[model samples]
Target: MAQALGAQTIYEIKQALHRCPVQLSRLVIHKTQDYALELVDYKVLVRLNPLCKALYLLFLQHPEGIVLKEMSLYKTELWNIYLQVCRHNDLKSAEKSVAELCNPLSNSIHEKIARIKSSFETLTDKHIAEYYIIAGARGKAKKIALPPNLIVWQ
Candidate 1:
């Protein structure tokens, strides 16, 4: 009866718009109104503190990866980024924090990156979180596994 009333309206099927395939590995870190890391496919949002977020942003800007042992070389650049995003005007304290972040001590940056990775891991599963983390071989430079094209600055 419905088909007779209107052929166009007769039982039809359509794909779900929401089900369109998303790049499961694609990730974005929002630095505009909020500080959060997102997994496009899974719609996962991981909010990060200003310090951690700044550190993560530094990695995003360096595609070739930065050597953990040579972090001191990036002190000025890292500090600049931190000052811009840390949401505070206290140069004295921000300077000190940046110093510690780029410190020569092997454990300093290692521990910080680990914390950021662990934070994301807690937001979703460890496997997905790994893609958002700074990872590399023992002696190789460390970088976020995400491709540059996939990153969204804002």
Candidate 2:
């Protein structure tokens, strides 16, 4: 009789778990509208510093990944993205910011990437955040691990 009750309790617990709603977060990048980042399922906007946002968007665009040393190749693209995301109209300052990021001698790129990682980790679980972060080993290409289907670019 005790065994029967335990089995019934287990079945009830499973049923309860099945009934609970699971939230699947989808990241939506608003490309045409100021490069805004949004969690579609949660209806929340993720705020990243202008430069960090530009870096994140660049990674999102390149699923194949990007090497740190090769950032100079993307200086133009990054600068363009930064221009749209940044509220200020200081073109010279924005250009300088992108130049520093592409300069291997400076640690600006690393700092921006760290800030971008922190932004996502704060919004969700570490495992989930991994999908939204720029990560890779030294001397290898870094990329966001999120599935392409989960990312929506507008």
Candidate 3:
């Protein structure tokens, strides 16, 4: 779908056409392949760096969303995911990276999330990207807007 027209206009057109079910690419997370991200409908792979992939996987797992200030609570989970996704052999270095990412005082996590957003933006229109990206207002829980039914864990 070309986004040359405004999102509202697109919505109105879809409404007029009576498109009951909006078509959205399903996001597949291959857990056996270290949580690889893919758009099954589009036949596209969403590549993210190790840390970013870890963060994204975490967000996907918790559709309820994760508040930034409370990221420390999920540090262990993130670290475990990072370990699976990262190719480095240095476990200590990986642990340190997770520590930095989960630190409330550090902006590392935000940077990784920004990269994740950029990756999705390049792959799809903003309206559709919103479904796959992690987003939320300040002081609130950030989450992927994609519905659970559209997500597959293999």
Candidate 4:
């Protein structure tokens, strides 16, 4: 029946079915002036590699995000050392905790921290901070307010 209606494959049919429930709900909500799609919460899981996990975890501990691209330029040596520490850790959990403990001073994780802060700042406008906070909080939903304003570059 799905194919007859122009869904090409079984995967397409499944995809359509998966999305139908949401679409139907949205359609019903559209009837109400107060309801909007932005209010709906949808989640997708991403599996991160060990290194990114370590980096992401470290960034979570900092109130400001890290700036990877700029940090790579200004603090190559410190970044290399941190990368080495990430490689030495056995488990992702240990890597995450150790990375936080290893760099308590903002100057210690300076470049990496800047990069992460920058990334989060960039995402603030798009409602991506919720995802970051969700990931950082390890799936614990915590209420977070967006920063006053993201720093804009010229």
Local accuracy by lDDT, each model: 0.73, 0.85, 0.88, 0.37
Stretches of candidate 3 off by over 4 Å are 1-22
**Considering every candidate listed, which one attains the maximal TM-score?**
3
The residue-by-residue lDDT of candidate 1 on 50-98, one tens digit each, is 6777788888889899988788898888877777677787889887877
- In model 2, what are the clashing residue pairs, if there are any? none
What's each prediction's TM-score? 0.75, 0.81, 0.85, 0.24
- True lDDT of residue 52, candidate 2: 92
Badly placed stretches (over 4 Å) of model 2 are 1-24
Q: Write the per-residue lDDT of candidate 2 for residues 1-154, one digit (tens) a residue.
A: 4353343576776666545554558899887778889989878888898889989988888999999999999998988888788886787888888999999889999999988888888887666687789999998999998888989988
For residues 14-113, write the lDDT of model 3, one tens digit per residue: 6554443457899999988878999999889999999999999999989999999999999989988888888878888889889999999999989999
Clashing pairs for predicted structure model 3, backbone only: none
- A best-first ranking of the candidates according to their lDDT comes to 3, 2, 1, 4
lDDT of 4 at 28: 14
- What would the per-residue lDDT of candidate 4 be over residues 1-154, giving only the tens digit for each residue? 8965468888888767655422111111121322111212322222333333345433433334444323333233434434543455455565454344344443434343344445544534233444343123322322223232321111
How far residue 45's Cα lies from its native spot in candidate 1, in Å, is 2.6
Highest lDDT model number: 3
